[model samples]
Target chain A: MKFSFPKKVMAAALCVAAFAGSAQAAEKVYRLKMAETWQSNFPIFGDTPRNMAAMAEKMSNGRLKITIDSANKHKAAFGVFDMVRSGQYDMGHSASYYWKGKVPNTLYFTTMPFGMTAPEQYAWFYHGGGQELMDKVYNKFNLMSFPGGNTGNQMGGWFQKEINSLEDLKGLKMRIPGFAGEVLAELGAKPTNIAPGELYTALERRTIDALEWVGPSLDLRMGFHQIAPYYYTGWHEPGTELQFLVNKRTWDRLPEDLQEILRVAMRTAAYDMYIQSYHASAENLEKMLTEYPNVQVKDFPADVIKAMQDANSKLLAEKAAADPLAKEILDSQAEYMKKARHWTDVSDKAYLNNFNAE
Target chain B: MKFSFPKKVMAAALCVAAFAGSAQAAEKVYRLKMAETWQSNFPIFGDTPRNMAAMAEKMSNGRLKITIDSANKHKAAFGVFDMVRSGQYDMGHSASYYWKGKVPNTLYFTTMPFGMTAPEQYAWFYHGGGQELMDKVYNKFNLMSFPGGNTGNQMGGWFQKEINSLEDLKGLKMRIPGFAGEVLAELGAKPTNIAPGELYTALERRTIDALEWVGPSLDLRMGFHQIAPYYYTGWHEPGTELQFLVNKRTWDRLPEDLQEILRVAMRTAAYDMYIQSYHASAENLEKMLTEYPNVQVKDFPADVIKAMQDANSKLLAEKAAADPLAKEILDSQAEYMKKARHWTDVSDKAYLNNFNAE
Candidate 1:
């Protein structure tokens, strides 16, 4: 009878242990580390990664935890792609165009010069096969890329003098980056890239005659209006979208539920950042106009605009001819933009024009 | 020793039972019922709630489950607010304006005539004090409301004839609901609301001279182009946002993690629907233009637009004078829109105009 009671106790204990094992498995927590291109405490750009991480943790009931390392910590602002791809970091937040030197096709995923607006670009990404083309490019690098956030139509740049015609661009030294810089170079302008910290000094001392930062969202804080009188409207990077990178191995290791939680969080954060940027721009622009009314918001004259367009088209054609995948991605974007821009013209464009009259 | 062995057996079994109880609690399923204003299989509007529910379930790892009943199943297209408020359904998906007759302040939560566009309105809701105002209105009814989806800029209805001047609006019969209908009535037009099923027949029988529907995203499927030759651009309901309703009791009953899951899911779905609507509009508009070459897209004449604006302002001034809360909400919107629109003018509007010139 003693042996029987002890045997029953052992059997019950074993069953409970088995049940507890499965329960622990269900309750297991996953920890991931991420790298972001921006420095700590950067306004809209830095907020995106932290926002995404917080949402994921809350939605997943603490089952998923993500820790972020900013450029200050990682000391790899431009190395986000390589760090995430090599699994040194499980994820990254950066702009896709930053990797263009290493992977030329990466340029198409970010906003192209004179491309679709924010809403149009989002539609193209989610519904018009832009995501598929992005996958085709990023899959080759053992990474997954997603639309991180959008900076609405960026300002053209703060110019010292008005751009009257194509002649004004000749020998003009400007701090513009990415494909836009290349487009400017084609028009006999000397395009240069300067560190963000040096931009104000560079423009002030005539090291560069013009500089393009983000729009009112980030620009008003940079105190650019104090130095530049001619604040030109945008022609390049109309809807500049940032990117999120995930290492394929890191993604594959996650449970299905965590994967979905991370995805939805990133998406919501991206959309939220766009609205946040819009709000900041509106608020900051109002402040700028009310305080310093001398910021001349000008559109580049028609001749100057036309010349920039021609230069952009020529550069795109050369890139397309050099690589088959580049041609495919460019063609897809063009086709999607044609349909989307038409709708934009009829809907928001028409409404805005009509409302302006009132 | 024999008594001691039996005691250990009992204690082990009891401990297992206790552990099993906590595990079950952790895995408890929360099944919620959602009632939608749309009929079964309704396109974009119906898809939103289902999308939100799926995300919540997946993110919560099946702890939260939501089942939806459409208008046909519930037999109460307009009773969504009442059902959700009374706890007959845990949630509802509908437009806030539909409840304006019952809760007068519900009107402003949807779009307004000559108001901000989608992106601008989203900024107002999230960043400005719009969400707080929305809460004050919905809280009285024991419900929580959220932005369900956005239908970009609604078309200014399909018209059988062009509106050239104020005279054309005199005694005209049109189908436009809510505040826009009231505005039109001030200009000697008869504005009526017709059931969706009966709108096509009413227009064909000359019972209505003009009727507004959503833009090309949904209008093409309704075959409005075949019957209406002149389609006008939108001024009223520029960014018609739908609403999601949750019973306060149901919300209070959820765990914190589930609440966050539901909140994030609905938010992501709302943004997704905006992009989806954009894509559908672009695709369907292309089809409409290609298939129906005779259909003309027109903007209301300057005089007609000006008259409509004046009438809208008069109606708004009367509302603001009627109640203190109404005045507060109106003043808030006007202030936010002014700042947002100025930024819009310098950014998106300038970019589009420059791009159009090329």
Candidate 2:
């Protein structure tokens, strides 16, 4: 899988001689393939891979080409990790948490219940050693994982009933998934998984009392507001960042310049997706409110929030005790978040409160 | 000053022919010169242009070479617009607001008092109608402006005495500049200006009662925490976005792929600076609190905040009345912020409040 020259050697030679040795490499076009976890033409999520591929192609001046296969074409929505690691695909765009079954440490890279917000999480990734920690987890599998995109603070879920206290969560049938669902299960709630296509009928027919999809960015088109009167503010998955995975074998084949182009393209597309999600959320939320004026946005009572937080803490503590790597990532995120959150409080929170009050 | 080949025609041709016709253009190196507003080695501000140049060069395999001249070399901290517009430099890295004196509409692009935060502002710039409005302003001058970097939410200022009421702002002498100063002047505060190098001494020697630099990201280095006891939260320049200006002539001369490389490079670099600033602010704020425990971060009292907000609205109204274009730009921002803020409240703000409370 390795190219004629290694990346490190190419980078070093390029540094010493500048672009003198790489002129020949520029004439040859290198093409790579990617597999995404979303269906073809799937709005914000689907746009990320296409955006990344287009930017890489344009930036490399036709030297690098990338083609993408979505879930429909690949027939593997949840098989992204396996496919990427086995070299069935050069890269993948999916969530890290999806691989928690195979690699438990993958759970921490996405979002956590009552964890950092979008900006805070990004600061953690780029500056607070999150990237290095991610490398430690993924490097063993010969894969590199990067922050693919963010859905901002996801809404908790659409609830048919208002959650007044801890008693309300008892025996509640909710379609929640992943780590957050595990946290809720500890609180006497029945957290089930329902197919996306069945979610609306399930909620309407009371197959599930509530379901946590995404925020308004994806939720508006789902028509959840029509059946669920109360849209609870988020606690679980505050900043749900998706993941980008690159197989080491494929990466080792890229020329230094094309490698740089691919890296920057992925990075830019990741950030762009976050902004796109934010814009979509804002636009969609406004549209939802105007169209469905009865859709009430609610916050869980203090006691309910407290119960959920306690459950989350217990789960994290158990995970931390079981694995040293899990302990390290959690500790890093907690420490970074404490300081970053303080700054957020004084800067954005304070300003927002003042401006909103005015 | 016109380039031989125009970008629009090239872009159209590339779209019709795909990458079929542009292979030969990739071999020729197109070097561009850029002038920045900061001095050589000025921390975050200086890092942006260098980062952009490095990415553009590496991504384009050195076909797009951008060399930067800082204020130390160019001797014009505020002359970026003129230099780029006249083709003295192919590009310039500076704040768009700095060109307010020369181009009155330039002030609206950087940031506004009581406006959107970094992510919101970025969403507006990229997804909202901001880029089109910017083109309307810059096209006639033969320049293109892009978001260079963001400084996040700036701190209000440091005060010698606490601002408890509207009376406190009256007759208070402060070294604040631009539109914020005009708002302060409306409240009978003496808005003065001082050179950056002399600011610390001026505040200490009672030459000024208060002053604001940037937030903790850049302010800690300036030693503002040592002298000022009361550090106020921001009301002005919530998301202070810097600008990168490109001479249209230079942009048109480049092959389409190189142009795309340069554009994406500038964009990624700008977003990186914002994350860099966020990380630095958190790290520096931690440092400041640990090293100097006496520094008290305060929000302006509700009454004072109301007065300032009122003054801001009044000024914006006057500006809108004076010029139709100013009215157009200001209205666009106001409308964007209104919907965006509502989403921010229910999403990030609510989640942050819940997490911080726990």
Candidate 3:
């Protein structure tokens, strides 16, 4: 009987050990490939995306790994949207304004000339059913996306000539896209399409007289100061938004647990991108002035801005008449702007207007 | 005969129009879901994340869409990592520190006491080869990530007890996570793991006497002042980092075009979340003080802080010895810190320490 008990104990322990071994083998690790649209070291562009990838790796505990394919290693900046849509890869990164050609109505959801501020945009999207409407528009793209970031109102384009009057804008070939391009057309400046890669050549060769990318941080890296001496402010694209797009097929294949990880990781990245970019913009702008005295940061002429505003009103009306999709997005934007403007009048804008920037 | 010629011309024009119409369907809008990690209007957490989604939608002209599912409606904060990892959903929203159980090495990527600041972290990740290392680690988890957001060196956590000496921490129960908890243990304090929801309850019941959250802004939202009268600073979790995670399978399926959009979106969102959060943290803290008269905000005692520093050194060494992964991360961190510390001593610290907040 004692001999039997020892044998039984040995059998139980072996079984337990076998079970543990099987359990360990059953564990699976998921590897994710992420593509970022920004350059490797351009403050907001590179750092934020990289930080986000790191955030997910940490969060997953070696179970879910995300690697960011930086610039050049992947396609150029404008290639992000198409890449995510075709399911050629997995998660992607890019700005919404970058997709204006294929989806014109998307610009309303992105940045507009003197549109809503950060707080206002947040309120409308979260509560006013704006996020739902945005989703409605993205459904046709064959991919799913999450709003990952915003550049709190941007500086206007870099110009080769002084835009002293609305007349100067006539026939002026400028690299501007989306809604801003439409608004600029009304003011008589010809809004031209040019990708970031082609921007330098176009500007240097005088193929495009003006270009508006992002703020100083990214602008400095693109060598804007070297080509364009006249850099203007009064950001036409205010509170520009960016997003993370995942292929729908790929997204649907994941079990519910993994999907949640992507969403949170993207958000962490979005937030990180903004603050890093903002500080970088500040730092780069200072550097631009000191490092290169030839660069002139000028404010846009008020009259030209007024003319553009007039054009935007007319263009918006025309768009509402032509495309129903455009109309719905424009309507959402209008309604959101109304409430956002009211709130800002009381809070954000009020503080900024009252509080002097030290 | 002349009439036949005119008719032929009209027919040719009609044929061209028909061909153009066939190609006019542009890409379909793509929709995705972003599981929220916080309430819809939860200041830095909610507003920025939501706006990022909105920005992506607007910029994509509706070709890309994302539905923002607020925290709990989809999953709890802690659940975000698993949700994304298992591919239960496509995207996620959360912080890196939350997943300490999985990837201990990831903590270096997120936040640590007196470690790299936002800029330094970015540098280490991108320039110092930290990003690739992080990616390798994340790949083991079946996910890719981006830095979702950042709370600039977070405010020392809130504490009810005045920590004048290291002895005060003995047996003190604090709600802390990641390496910071280990440091606390080394210092003789008991670190407690508690969810954000249960935080107020635990403190109110004295189940946990002290809690360290993101910063003053988030602390105000939790109304920690009511339960903990004396709020102390937490130097340990300076610069808490959030993350957005994506499931690997879902990520690899995206086409190159959509990939660009998602990548830029993540970059944009990351940048925006940080600055907006910083601004919100400042405003909320000020508002909390004015609104709640009974609350007291105090910095950690010098001696107590010194002890925590000592604890950090020992804990780091122990971590390095036990886990190769932990050692790899820490070594990478220490390497980057060695280089960046010199600059921080001159630029970052000098500005903050000498500048006038007023």
Candidate 4:
């Protein structure tokens, strides 16, 4: 039998349906895909993106879901920038310097040779115009880049022999990559890029005389300490921060609440990784010393450090002269670093030196 | 005109009502009130809780709302712990050391006299056992404490006369509070607590010989550089971290999603505050130098530093001997700092010294 409700009752039913439909929309699940540069189960590097995604998902109460595809699944370790930029993936976890060849300005967003430390660089990024400069460079490419994680102060390299003077570095063959490699090349060192998988073999078999990997966090697993006797302290890539890249369109489409969740998740993950790296480095360094007594930690001598510094300065000057944007970024970093380093010198540096002497 | 044989339609309407009811429940708003130990508009200290509240609200889509009442409104600067404990307030933002009188173990959560720097302390808190120890302390009072923010490295103080020897500290009336003051008192320094508003007048009029406030981040407005010639570097409170206390009941009432949101928001805000403090200190220090050119930055003489270190060590030993829990927390920090400081020594310290010498 054909039956219809009264007008008031029908209006009330329609209102209820509208309310339920809107509520369902509010609870709609948004699934995003991310591509990371590291392979599956990679220690610190791989965990950063997963940590971020998990926080975002949990905070959003399953309404926001992010699935990550590692280099193993994507088969493109250095293709993170392109993948995220082209929207093939909604986001990417990689280092900004990895894309320097394609976009030269991307180099500065990651750590630089002889630049600010982690806290200093973070101040620059969040408060001293570094993020704006980063946005200026990445916005043109339809990508948003963020500081993903830090490897604290990276070790310079695992040297088979101590770098005592400039003469020692003249003919050295090392597996150092990116702008740092360029700096070494200027100082007459034969800098080369070898695959990560072959780094230990390369160093052990004398194919490469020395190689700079990450610090104790990721280095212990590679067995660099066992093969190389002299573990040089960091010079290049002091505070090596990884990058988080999101396609601009993907970011724009997110709801305000989810956007806040994603922003905070990435930030906390970045900070957490720095502390994690610090903890791991401390733990592993102790282990290396205890297990392998022959491993010697050395700093590059004054003259050699000076030579590298000069070479780095020359290279940076050339880059600044070549591009206005590069000039702006370099100048901003140098100015910020000057003030920040001054504070650091008087605070942590002085306190450490004074307390240690006591 | 009575409706008949419409049982199916009635059942459908009832189902819609149930859906709407459940949806409304899901959208329920959770309001929280926080009492802060700082006055309204207190720069870095006040900004932290507000930043946290804003992030939590946005991330929760307004479902989680936190309203903060400053000390001016609450009129109980030191009542934050008790307020949150008794459920008078849902949360609190204050320094952990402020509650040491009420709960002695609470002092360790803030910075110590000679302790780890910001990053080192953060590593100890998250990766080491600091957070667990803090939980153990706070959980007993039916509260949960989290790291609220960091003021970076605190300045030693603005001194009217330079302290070059331990003898200079004798009968020195200084406005330094908490455990550091106790350590100073052990060294024959007359340590006293002065109200914040009277600090400048006290120091300026020679009522107090030296006063240790925060670093340049909060020091610029006080005009201490103009009044005091010697701006000594930080020794005590290397990384003064503020604390966030949540009532156990308040935390338990939050939904899982809201809890996650709140957790991440506070973590990010704490990190942000550190960067902000670093940036402000850098900017303000530069301004201080340019404006007040006579302000001399000095480090405590080595002998004096040694004396202070011994005094601090002795005081700490007494505390550890007295309380088992205090011993556990202090021992955890000492062990963690040993390893972390070694890494710091070889990493950031080595890098900074090497680069600067270049």
What are the models' TM-scores? 0.97, 0.94, 0.50, 0.97
Please give the TM-score for the first chain of candidate 4. 0.96
Writing each residue's lDDT as its tens digit, candidate 3 over A1-358 gives: 5775565556556544543443232224667676778766655656555666665544333445767786678856678878777766677777776776787766566666656654456545655566787787777888676666766546677889998887888999999876778788776678988767889999999999998887775788888888788877644665666777777887787544345546656765665555455445645666777778987766556666666666777877897999998788778777766644432332222222222121
Stretches of candidate 3 off by over 4 Å are A1-26, A38-43, A70-79, A194-207, A293-295, B1-358
lDDT of 1 by residue, B86-111 (tens): 99999999999998889888999889
lDDT (10s digit) by residue, model 2, range B240-294? 9999999999999998888899999999999999999999999999999889999
Clashing pairs in 2: none
Error of 3 at B299 (Å): 34
Residue A323, model 3: lDDT of 90
Considering DockQ, which of the candidate structures 1 and 4 is the better prediction for this target? 1
- For residues A261-295, write the lDDT of model 4, one tens digit per residue: 99899999999999899999999999988889999
TM-score of chain A of 1: 0.96
RMSD of 4: 1.8
lDDT of 2 at A348: 95
The residue pairs that clash in candidate 1, if any, are B157-B212
Residue A151 lDDT, candidate 4, scale 0-100: 91
lDDT of 4 at B21: 66
Question: By how many angstroms RMSD does model 2 differ from the true structure?
Answer: 7.6
lDDT string for model 4 (B195-231, tens) is 9999999999999999999999999998898899999
Please write out the lDDT profile of model 3 over residues B229-264, one tens digit for every residue: 775544665555677777777667654434554665
Q: Per-prediction DockQ scores?
A: 0.71, 0.39, 0.02, 0.69
